[model samples]
Target chain A: MRNCISCQIKAKVEQRNEDLNAKLAFLTMPQPASFSDVVLFADDDDEHPVPVPAHKAVLANRSPVLRAMLDNEMKESLSGTIKIGDVSYDALRAFINYLYTAEVCLDQQLACELLVMSEKFLVQHLKDFCQKFLVSNLNLDNSLSTYTFAHQHNFKPIIDAALTQITASMDKLASQDEYTVLKERDLGLLLEIYEAYFSKQADTTMYI
Target chain B: MRNCISCQIKAKVEQRNEDLNAKLAFLTMPQPASFSDVVLFADDDDEHPVPVPAHKAVLANRSPVLRAMLDNEMKESLSGTIKIGDVSYDALRAFINYLYTAEVCLDQQLACELLVMSEKFLVQHLKDFCQKFLVSNLNLDNSLSTYTFAHQHNFKPIIDAALTQITASMDKLASQDEYTVLKERDLGLLLEIYEAYFSKQADTTMYI
Candidate 1:
């Protein structure tokens, strides 16, 4: 007799796994190298726009912002070309690939860029993915930069996390090169750091 | 301090969950109600086939048979109409929906029909899903007919499962109306059952 052990439960797990695998097979689209209705060009490609072919339906389905842009009789819709400014070709390609496949390899830099693009395009799922990556990877070295980036983008979780990290290690705060840069470039941001540090100290003292 | 026991492991699980959720979101397409490049009609809809709109790219991706029909310059491809014979309109719609979403609420009859269709289309994933459903739902009541259906389609798993169920309840088999019908309609299948029964007896005798 087949042992009535972990496999009995594993059978259920395997069934669910099969269901998701089928769904994924149904949903995942291979990058459309043909029959493309529109093309996207990176801003850096000025002399000749490097074209990235895509289906309008797929683009519109993934992003409401893209849907609006393509659905309306805009200049881009009429011309069949979308010129995306202030982005590298690599980032633009990854962005489109993620829209189609939702798979990307991210470092700190790529995550920041994708997060900004996800926000601008109103792809909330991608934005959340990037935010989670950034938050999980936070450390002393990148805390100040992440805090500033989070502040600029109104990322509440990242702001809270970066603030916590920055204030927790305030003993060496004044000796860092970024400390001088922040003091000179944005005194308001520097003062906010002081506020966070003092507030954390007061909270600890109260607990004691 | 937050408990470390669960959080340490939960953080990894949550990351994986987030990845899957994002992929699902990217892959789950809304039904293409408009801008469909191709239309499928059930063969029964002779005069005015109730058109089920779909994209060629999606159709081609899901089924190699559909891909071949759409990719080559055929009459259906030229006219942008595909006629699917020997299927109900409801089944055809559900088939297309499953191709899009990989989801369906199945009954025995529906599962059989879909298994046949999935096989015809060479969609192995859907074929396996329908086969598993039919195999799991097999019982003495349905085993004879299920056996015949599975036999016709050369579905080995279902055939084996139904055969096992049918042979186990040989005492009640002669009383069923399906047994009488099988005797009249397909004598070969009836003889095969006797062969199976005797073979099982010999095996049991050997074990003893």
Candidate 2:
């Protein structure tokens, strides 16, 4: 009886060590391919991996605030398409990945996309990023685009922030003759500055 | 014929003014119960509003990087659930709202949420805020929680950063008898510190 008990204990230890090895192997494995068919294998016996509902998965994966915002915007916007710029397809893909894995790779384009999406989703971090990106990349050309996009989206605060950025850039540009001529002819810049300054005045008046 | 033409021009002017008034009304009005709904209705019925697709709307309303991260994680984890903190939810929602409306209210909670969600979504500004928050809130209890969470999530750099924070706090705690006694009894803390320090050493050795 003692010999039988000792043998069982030995077998259990071996099994545990094997399980640990398997787990380590999984952790060390290289990431799979991007495309579904090439990377993941669909179970032959089952239609799906887990029988969890799609909506539940989405809810579980998405932030409650983002889900609410998406629903709200979908309800509110007559046009469903929200225009996003300075954000590429890859960056969008990366953000989605992070939502799932809590992991992400940051880059310039990804940074821009993160900002635009954050603004669209009412994600504060993304908006701050967009603001910072606009502020950091504030220049004659980009600022104009940022200003126009913010206004078009009715992102008044972003518009205001971008406008402030543009105004600051404009101040710097005003010192140069080339920028002055460019600002005069650039209808986008002119409109952005006018809107930004006026909004600021309006905001101050409301507070007063 | 000349009188008729003049009358037609006046009618056109009246229509233009009416259109402008409607736009002004929209701008002046507090956000309608369904702002996106109004926009969607306008886009469908009026020539002025552009058509936006549902999927694109989803994309536009989400942080691109976050969205991408979500997608990637969805593909990779396939069956994993992400546990989000309270702060992350707030930031994500605020950011999403900004994306849709381009306006944000910066409150302490909102800022903290944004920071947490940014780290989750891999948004730079959010990450920066998370770092800033960590730096500002550097203390034994908070750092311990931060370190443990960061480690669990496999946030290498963040874990490293948090470790530095933990060490600094530990240095302070080491002087206190209560902390040492607590540390002896707290298995979770002991395990966490052991694993963190050992893993870090392993990483350093691998690099070497």
Candidate 3:
């Protein structure tokens, strides 16, 4: 196959198989192992030292920068134990997968956990993705968990964005009879968020 | 294995596999057999459509919104026979895959083509990703392409952001050698962006 360098398309030719295999071989030379320790520690026969799936593992393998980051993270953890918020090993693994594959298969709780980890680890891209996801999927009743993440991580941009969205729907949120009951049950945090946002608005207007 | 909704992690599950699968299936389904008698078609068997390889088909199966947009585009093309841009059927397919998968295995030229299509289609997320990729991968000589994308898409936000970054590195970007080369090679567009941004800044200052 003739490969177009500009667009990476493969054109059919009599020597397609030979050309493709050659190109694949060049592209697949293990992409210069990013996590030297991970690579070194794993048995040669073992596919992945960390238990990520094969497809995702291949994606991770191709990204040398991401691999290096993971290696550095592991090294730091082993040497002095760096904390990624309240994330456990599982959450860290999921976050790594999300970074490499942009495919995360985790529960909302784990997603929140990974968002916290993304913040602690200074994974700005991951944090941005998480914030976007939260904003796109916000539900007033269920948003408390996401709000907590926004608050705790000091993801001020995300908090600002979410507040705009939630505040716009304040009447609908208040009208939800079931949610009103739940708010009555746990009014402290709810009141705190309201007061905080209102004060923030007041401060902005005062500045104006 | 149990699915997300029925699994022990039900409460935590943020996304379900079925949701993604359903979306993908919808995207891949063949266009209606008869669109006003034009009869849009695919070459491969309906059961096994053209497999553009996993990596190459970045947006192979995307959200229904994007798929609908593509279908409408195809229908419009068939009806009006107006092809203004360089977008081809294959390019549109690849662009869709890039949207869904967040990765495209196309070459730089094809990627640029897809980026233009994304902008035309109002796929802001894809446009943003493409712009970021182009900027990060750019060199002084090759940076013109990134600038072109910024100009064409009216991606003012990205352009403004890039200008801030580049100007912040004025010592590097505006060195004697670099400044002379850029002035001679890209003077028109450079001045345009400069004037637009400077005017915006002036407006903000006046308001302040």
- Leading candidate by lDDT: 1
State each model's CA lDDT, in order.
0.83, 0.45, 0.49
lDDT (Cα, tens digit) per residue for candidate 3, span B70-164: 34455532352222245555765565445434445665666577677776665655665566666666555444445556666666655665565
User: For model 3, how big is the iRMS in angstroms?
Assistant: 16.8
Cα displacement (angstroms), candidate 3, residue B26, comes to: 30
Query: Which docking category, incorrect, acceptable, medium or high, applies to candidate 3?
Result: incorrect
* Stretches of candidate 3 exceeding 4 Å from the true structure: A1-36, A39-85, A105-107, A171-208, B1-208
For TM-score, the strongest prediction is 1
Candidate 3 versus the native: TM-score?
Answer: 0.31
Candidate 2 CA-lDDT value? 0.45
Cα-lDDT of candidate 3: 0.49
List DockQ, one per candidate, in order. 0.47, 0.01, 0.01
A1-208 in candidate 1: lDDT tens per residue? 5668655655665565556655675677775654567899999766876788887777788888888888768787778788888787888888898887777899898899899889899998889889989999999888888888888888899999988888988887788777787888888887898898888889999999
TM-score of chain A of 3: 0.48
C-alpha RMSD for every candidate:
2.9, 24.9, 24.0
TM accuracy, model 1 = 0.89
Best by DockQ: 1
